[model samples]
Target: MSCATLFPRLLGDVGGTNARFGWQAAPGQALQNIRVLACADHAGIDLAIEHYLHSEGLDRPRAACLGIACPVTGDSVRMTNHHWAFSVQALQQQLGLQALRVINDFTALALSLPDLPADSKIPVGGPLRGAEQAPVALIGPGTGLGVSGLLPSQGQWLPMAGEGGHVTLAARTALEFETLQVLQHRFGHVSAERVLSGQGLEDLHAALRCVRGDTAPQQPLDAAGITRLALQQGESSCLQTLDMFAVFLGRVAGDLALTLGARGGLFIGGGIVPRLLGWFEHSGFRREFEDKGRYGVYLAEVPVWVIHTEHSPALWGAARALDQLH
Candidate 1:
């Protein structure tokens, strides 16, 4: 079925690993359909859409908004890690969508911050701002790292759309510098995403293994698998991995907070953080976030939170983006 023939416009959050789809049956209403279609499963966007629709018993949607992990430039969107590429206008015409919107996944997540339900988030450190002037920062890691900020303006929040995650991942300690050196050998131009994400955690484990004189596993381990091992209560190596991931995330989060002046506070989101909530709060994340030189006190005052919403945020962000059309 073509998108023109479907009712209840579809909204999607297409990331490096999964493509989440849903429908806005009415204004401000989010009807979700979690489709675990790997990008590697389909040949292209159209085929993926068809598979999702057939599996969900839906026809083509009219107005659609797709939140992709890659930067949305011009009419073409080619994913960085996934082998998927498509022309927006051409796909809209092919699907018969009246209107189609494409936005970066992180940007969409940032847009959904203001409307996030209280139950969806858990405060990590300090209190959030009561005033509307403060800016909020969103940082997440999954297939890659994502960063964005939102500032209050014109009676609503305005989200910043930039590639802040790809910026240099700074190290303030000798051990961290060593980790950077190890990673630099594997991936030449290392970014924050290289060290602060799931893949980074695995890499950290591999390096730690090397440092401990144990051969690292040749087969790759998924993010959840590593996190589970760490959270199991008796595995020292996994615990070390989790601890390092948290501390480094704290350092990076602090960097993002300083860069954006996120007085409203910082948020931790992504596929991994929520699962390690306990470890994160008890780990060096909060302390490291406030470890800046003279500005330590200033950063200490800024609050940080972890998003616990299990419904997924990028989808809500896509819906929020769609609401902006009015």
Candidate 2:
């Protein structure tokens, strides 16, 4: 269904890190007034929307859809990684929107997979052709790891709602085994998200430092800092850390691809990955991805892509959801 009817409506993709806002101008029209606002600066969703609307001198939109990082079970939603909480109905009333829709951020992203342009994605590995009919996997490492899929069935792509990121991650090989052992002592269960998320990058560095007998390490580095240090061209430690991250990411992506038989390709979203694309394309990620015992050949043919669009995907997905409802 075309989104023309939702024209001039407000769309938001809210996350723990940033809140992306946009307006759907018309069916097949480019989303406009795209803006990213720091969620930490606002006290709540209403205030955040108010700040954006007031700053732009815009009127309250007729219809609104929010792609929130937290689960939208009922009226209230409490973000898992942020301190924000509010009721959807209340927000609609406060904003005077005729209809308001809210969905999980990852689910929203899954919806927009079929709509992303070729220029917005970068291929990391695998066959690029004939992926249109295969199931697509979507995974991202941000405030938390998100995993979902778009399964094509009977001509329409259906979104799969599952917690694939929470699955157990087994460490193969000596070095990876050592990293696992180091992390096991700190956290009981070592899920993939534990080592592939923002804090996961730091956890990897710390684990490596500990394994290498590096004096317990000092200085707390965020994900970006760790990536910057790795991409500095000559930092051995940072390079090792990034290599570890890339390989692990590939392994995770490969596993997801195999689990879903996602020959349609695996799309990487979230705030990370895009900056480290150059390093990723040259890393051991591809080799590790196709390292699955005998099923390696099957995975070797599946494509992988990185969603690099700055557009508010969740907003678009939310709009899609609204259109589906109508």
Clash number for each model: 4, 0
Model 1: residues with Cα > 4 Å off, grouped in runs: 1-7, 32-34, 128-131, 216-220
Q: Candidate 2, after superposition: displacement of residue 234 in Å?
A: 2.3
Candidates in order have lDDT scores of 0.79, 0.83
lDDT of 1 by residue, 1-326 (tens): 44333346777878888887776665645575666677878898889888888888886677888888888878998986688999998999988878788999888888888877888778777665533578888899888888898988877888887777788887677767777778788889878888777777888877766666777456765677788877875478778777777788888899889888888888877787888876678888998888889989888888888888756677777766766764
- Using alpha carbons, what is the TM-score of model 2? 0.92
Q: What is the Å distance of residue 54 in model 1 from its true position? A: 2.0
TM-score of each: 0.92, 0.92
**Model 2 regions more than 4 Å off:** 1-7, 26-28
Candidate 2 residue-wise lDDT, 1-326, digit = tens = 33336556788889888888887766676777788999999999899999888887677787778888866778988887789999888999999877888888888899998888899989987877536688989999887788888888899878776667677888777988998899989998998888888888889888888889889537977788888877875578778888888888889988898889988888899877888887788799889889999999998888888888767576778777777756
Top candidate by lDDT: 2
- Kindly state the number of residue pairs that clash in model 2: 0
